[model samples]
Target chain A: MYIHAVSHYFPSEVVGNEHFTRLNGLSSEWITERTGIRERRKAAPDENTNTMALEAVRRLFDQTAIDPSQIDLIVGATYTPYDTIVTLAHVVQHNLGVPDIPVISVSTACSSLINAVEVVEGYFAMNKATLAVVVVSEHNTAYNNETDTVSGHLWGDGAAALLISKERISDEDMTIHTIITGGAATSGKATTGVMLKPLEQGVLMPHGRDVFINACLYMPKVSLQVLEKHNLTIDDVDYLIPHQANLRISLNVINTLKLPETKLLSNIQKLGNTGCAGCAIALSENRALFKKGQNIVLTVFGGGYSFGAMLVEV
Target chain B: MYIHAVSHYFPSEVVGNEHFTRLNGLSSEWITERTGIRERRKAAPDENTNTMALEAVRRLFDQTAIDPSQIDLIVGATYTPYDTIVTLAHVVQHNLGVPDIPVISVSTACSSLINAVEVVEGYFAMNKATLAVVVVSEHNTAYNNETDTVSGHLWGDGAAALLISKERISDEDMTIHTIITGGAATSGKATTGVMLKPLEQGVLMPHGRDVFINACLYMPKVSLQVLEKHNLTIDDVDYLIPHQANLRISLNVINTLKLPETKLLSNIQKLGNTGCAGCAIALSENRALFKKGQNIVLTVFGGGYSFGAMLVEV
Candidate 1:
């Protein structure tokens, strides 16, 4: 499979650390030192997961003209959903005017984008669909608890769209070599570590240490496994776009892999954590920097304690 | 792929239509005439989506002892999720003690089981997983608005588990021939027809007529589409397990397909609409009747306005 185009849309409003500091009594310096998040984008009150996703799809269309009729699959991945009933996939399919294709919305929490892509891979492999759209959108701000001191400032609302094809449609299309995802919920703190109780608490991380430890272990571990499966090594990877969960986690992955910090591509410093959209947004941000024959890997770990890695050859 | 085993679990609480008559003033006779439902299963106050799903999986284990280490994939399909963050997939994975496999939760609303099976198809085609479990679970009662007159009586809490293998494991194994799913959200009444607002008015069918109209049109249409895709005809099908949305919809599909009423395998009269788990639960209910060389088709239409048909040869 190949990526024809990728695009991301972030809400226009920039919420600086001062906002969280004022709301949660956490210092700006403390927030930055802890998470490396200075300011993150927050959706307008009227905007949400679906709107941001639509804009990202519009951007994908603007980037490259795609025949809406030929698109056979649409997969939306998110945990913090706007409307689980209407769903991001249906809304995207409705707005994109794509009819009669399989519109599936999936969530393995923050590792959802990889799972969505894996869903597309299934369709492509079955000859069920040739052109597929994997839309990753997250309205973290919509479920953000501004008063929580632990993870109050760690969320941003954003969406990313990827136009993936069963085969290379153009020379610029990047080939997806391998994608691997697994669950570790059997381990400690998988359920209680990060919770999104829309009715009770918004989004909270009660055991940040457990999450940090598991993410640190699994992200690099899965990255290496995916690399080893393809007989490739970390040295061959040109860029590593880890899930934009925390800058410290990404740094840990870099340190474990023994790569320079420049090899790590991230957007959490400016955009906070956009959930599943995080890695996809970072990929879109770095799309122009990719060169032919360069290898890029997007490795992710989620709140369900799910982890995944996708290898892309640009 | 072939089915290793199929199992279903319904909560002990039987919610008869008289309960709806008491709550929403809809007579029991009226409900049976309108939706072909007399009574439905409701989970106890403590029972939930995950617990029911785990029970169904345990039943699968009880029926057959498969190596837990070989289960490489677990796909959970549900629209009415208890906790979207931890997700049914992760919970089942954690409870099953099946570590390090791909755990994905997918929703295309009530047509989710077919989509979940399709996800497993992808993993199988890619050689990613050989042994997979597609767990269809729904906690619709948790979100059902008992006071809503339209769809108040059309929900039940139940779960079904299907252990599918890439290759047949035994002589009794049923081969999945064709599975086709599509979205119809581009058409009218897609979004607002069947809504599940967790915090607001829970599970409302504001456009029951639109849902009924579309369900009647697409259920048989996709049934024939899947049949034709495999060069089979309606005459080849020994049983039709339509989505248990309503008795009226299933009867319409039988009429459209020119099949006898006896050919229709239904459980809606007793289970109401179990959402995505409905058809699978029905299949499990009638499992013993399936004979060698018999062709069974499970066709479904869901609230997201998604439709699918899966053809299986026993």
Candidate 2:
């Protein structure tokens, strides 16, 4: 499968480090030093996962000549959902006015975006679908308790859209060389690290240290594993977009992979953790800078502990 | 893909019509007349989606020779999840001691089981996985309002499991010939008919009549569509297991298909609406009686209005 187009949406509301300083009693310098998140985007009260997702897809359609009718499959990835049943996928499908097609909403927590792409790949392999649209929206603010001191300030709302094809539709499209996703619940302290309790406590990261340790261990391991499948190495990677959770984690992954600071592309400094939309949003932001034969690796680790890496080349 | 084995689990607690009559102030006769659900299985207060799923998969493993290590993929289907982030799939993987593999939890509402099967089919097509286990569990009681009067009596909790293979592992295995899924959020009254608000209203069916109308229209349509893909019709199907939402809905579907009442297999009169687990539980319950050369059509219509049909041959 190939990535035909990519687009992203972040809310207009800018939340700076000072906001967390007042709410959680943490100093602005401390927050910046710990997370490297100087500021992040927040969705408005009326904006939600579905709305942001719709906006992202509309942006994709506006920028590209691809018509909505041509999309045979729609996959929505989100861990924070406004409505779990009428899911983000269903709402997007309803608003797009697209006729009956498979609109599946999938989750492996924050690794959901990669899983969503895998779903599209599956549809393509079975001859069930050709042109597929993947919309990833995270409405963390809707579910995150802003007053919680633990991990409240870490979340930011965002959405991204990607148009993919079974075959390369244009020379501009990037060939997706591999997608490798796996569960790590058996790994040390995975189940208790990070959590989202939609109806009860909202989002919480009680074991942030364990999560950080596991993420640093997995992201580089999976990235290298996927590269091995294509007989490639870290040296061949032109860019690396790790999950936008913590900047320190990104640096740790790149260091382990022996990639230079310039090769690591991160938006967590400006966008915080956008969940499934994080890496995709970063990909959209940087896709224009890519040259032919340039390789980009997107790696992720999610709460409840799912990890994946996707290798795409222009 | 071929189905190697099937198993299910329903809590021992039986919730009868009298319980609803007392809670919702609805007469038992009226409830039975409308839904044909005299009594339904209910999970205990402590039992949730993941627990029920674990039981279902354990039963499956006990009855089959497949080891946990042999499973390459675990796909869990649930609209009523115990935890949205850690997910039923992750918890199942955690407890089973299964090492890292793709453990995906997917939702397309009550049609989730068929969609999960399609996901496994996709993996098989891509050669990403060979032996797959799909667990569908719905803890509707955890989110349903017993005093709501409208849909309070319509929910029951149960879970089912299926072991599927990329190749025909045994002569008794049923070959999955066709799997078709589509979104119908574009259809009339879809968004409003039935909804699950995990953080707010729980489960609500404010527009039951509209859902009934659409369910009647889509179930037989998708069933016949899947049959036509394989150059077969209603005559070729030996059994029809429609979504176990309401027995009246099942009758209407069979009536539209012109299949004999005896060919219609329904557990709704006993199990209630087990959400995503409904049809698969019905399939597992009746699979022992299926003769060689027989065909079974499992068709479903779900809230948020996703629909699908799968045709399997013995």
DockQ of each: 0.71, 0.76
CAPRI quality level assigned to candidate 2 from its DockQ score: medium
Chain B TM-score by candidate, in order shown: 0.98, 0.98
Model 2 lDDT per residue over B35-59, tens place: 9898888888779888999999999
lDDT of 1 by residue, A86-121 (tens): 788998898888889989999899999998999899
Residue A26 deviation, candidate 1, in Å? 1.0
**lDDT of each residue in A1-314, candidate 2, tens digit only:** 89999999999999998998888898878877888888889999889888899899998888678788888899998888777788888887887778779989998999988899998999999998999989999988888888888788899999999999998888899999999999898887777788886657668899999999999999999999989999999999999999999999999999999999999999998999999999999999998899999999999999888999999999
Candidate 1 off by > 4 Å? none
Q: Model 2, residue B62: what's the lDDT?
A: 90
Error of 1 at A219 (Å): 1.0
> TM-score of chain A, model 1?
0.99
